[model samples]
Target chain A: MTTGVRRRMGVEERRQQLIGVALELFSRRSPDEVSIDEIASAAGISRPLVYHYFPGKLSLYEAALKRASDDLAARFVEPREGPLGARLLRVMGRFFDFVDEHGPGFSALMRGGPAVGSSTTNALIDAVRQAAYVQILSHLDVQDPPARLELVIRSWISLAESTALIWLDGRRIPRAELEKQLVHDFAALAAVSAAYDEEMGALLRRILKDEPADGPFADLVGRIVALAS
Target chain B: MTTGVRRRMGVEERRQQLIGVALELFSRRSPDEVSIDEIASAAGISRPLVYHYFPGKLSLYEAALKRASDDLAARFVEPREGPLGARLLRVMGRFFDFVDEHGPGFSALMRGGPAVGSSTTNALIDAVRQAAYVQILSHLDVQDPPARLELVIRSWISLAESTALIWLDGRRIPRAELEKQLVHDFAALAAVSAAYDEEMGALLRRILKDEPADGPFADLVGRIVALAS
Candidate 1:
């Protein structure tokens, strides 16, 4: 390849570049509002060149959504070293970081994508939820989570999604506070379930056993106890 | 009045009847799958007669959704006599009753309606959420809810919605348990918020002060305290 000769982009590189351009545009406005022409222009390529990479706008939208889903799922990952509460706080912080950066795209993803009854869109969304669920389970070090545990995990995931969605509407609440509150919400959800079931109680105790006094879970305990005073 | 002859339904009554029939059909299936003919046939009338009442299927669907929204909002209402937990449990029971009877319709409503960019549908759905929020605030007996209190209430409403939506998928969890669990989830969410904000903490204590020992809120406190032991 000649140096600085405007080297021709490889087929895969060009496709990735187009997806990046589309995703950036989509992050600003809903996918329905962003046109393929705008995407092509933003990429500094002709409309036909864009079409050459992807079949249609819907297809391109799905590709961009897939990329976002992966980015979101990765946000849920954290090292298993720290206490679970601190780990979750970090995870939530990163999770909101993505939301803060990609407000419209995150909203669209939570709303199940724009207008199309695409199974691909549904699967991508479900994949992100499942990824978060599995990561939480891994943190718990459980081989098989009981029904109530599963319920708590799944419900908390939904809470986080809705909380972020609502927060995106003007984001009236400070992002940092919401992030810390989400971590506490997870603990509260699990604690309530633990109050009901023996299995959940045991699970909650085990999880709380290793938590530091300054951790979110312990902070919740201290706050609840203070109420009794 | 002609004796022993079929009486024509008054226009208002007939319109209400058509909406009832359409809502029944939409409850069994999504609004998208139900048609104008079905509504007319269900009402023992002709298609033209159905069109005489409502201009089109979308209009009929909107009418039906309006009725369902009213019914759903009604489910959240409770007498303020009992402890808040018990009151909330009864409300959740009725709420799930609606979800149980109208699983598909509930799912569609939660998913923001089927295939149409109908602002009416959106408005009706939002009306239900707003009604639920207002009802919850009333149950708390707060004149001016603090920001954190508002967040807890809104987030809990969203949680209840998503929990029901997930449960409808397979009916895997027992409805009664889920109902009770939802009451616990609300207390848990509020308690966590209370831990952080003074306004929320005061509100939570006031609410819990009225709760009985056997009530869900106290049960949650007992469970969390047991873990500490």
Candidate 2:
């Protein structure tokens, strides 16, 4: 929250400061709409000094994206305790909190394809996805997830991204409800994948073993069975 | 497929031809990468004539986008018969077929921000979404679906878009399997929404009444119940 002029810092610290400033600005507006001069002024520095760190707006934008990606990746590192559903809810809470903080930049970085759709941009974005994938596996205690589990995880990530965008865009339901909806869909996806892959079925069973009777996963099972009966 | 010299046509039909040629060109690359001469050449027409129909490249791109949106909107209109699962599969088939035919264009139009992001562009894209919403309501035989049902429908459409992009981005998974996965998710989403709303629950119950006992929906329910036991 501190934006006032600070004492002279080392080169690495200065670069981080400028990139952090740029990330906050880019988080609200598109990269093209932001100017290097604006970023410099926002950081309590001169334009030339900003150029000394990043040659141009694109370089600065890339750094900002990388910084944001790193920050988001860090959020996925929740403790791998409790039921998988609880751990996932913790991760998703942080995930949605990040979305709430960095709305536009998250959309651009997460759904890379036009303004920041370069190969470099994609690598930065993929790094965040890779972090989430690894975090999910850690929660499942699966050092090597089966191929089907991997596919469903990737699909669930896509579902989460799209769901976030939709939920954010509409602001229809409360954030807690949106988080609960994600947990429900993820559990249902695990169940659906279970029909095809025994490993996934086993994983779902193992995770649900710790689930309380009145938990979201149990309710999902209950509601689904209600429809069948 | 005929692109050679053609007989003179009326103003509307000729405009359609130019737009069609532009669509094919845009399908392969972004609008910025595509040129007016290339579109004219592909249509066996002159640059001036291309401008005669559309004032400039932006206008032509917008027109082509409108055309593609209309084509995509048309694909979601499936007959309201059989189980909802079966009907959704047919619509998804045509939807994915459109994605296959207009791959790059579909990505640009559906994920509109950066490449084709504008108030006008957003309106066109939302029109396609609006069409799909109405189409789904018709399939459900619900003139006024519950608000939660509306949210899930919108979420499913977004999921379909992201899923198509991911599935296309990595051709590791076969398209048929991807399509099946979409149908499965769509059904699960419907069931999940059912748990939150009375109308959705009833709508789902009616849909499942006609759903085959061994179909994906029943299988999902059976698996979830397996965890309950």
Best by DockQ: 1
Q: List the residue pairs that clash in candidate 2.
A: none
Candidate number of the best lDDT: 1
Worst 10 residues of 2 chain B by lDDT: B110-119
TM-score of chain B of each: 0.93, 0.88
Write down the TM-score of every candidate.
0.88, 0.78
Q: Candidate 1, what DockQ?
A: 0.46
- Residue B110 of model 1, lDDT score: 66
Off by over 4 Å in 2: A1-12, A28-41, A46-58, A104-123, A141-148, A197-216, B1-15, B25-63, B103-124, B141-147, B169-177, B196-203, B206-216, B226-229
lDDT (C-alpha) at residue B2 in model 2: 47
Worst 10 residues of 1 chain B by lDDT: B1-10
For candidate 1, give the lDDT of residue B174: 90
Model 2: share of real contacts kept:
0.41
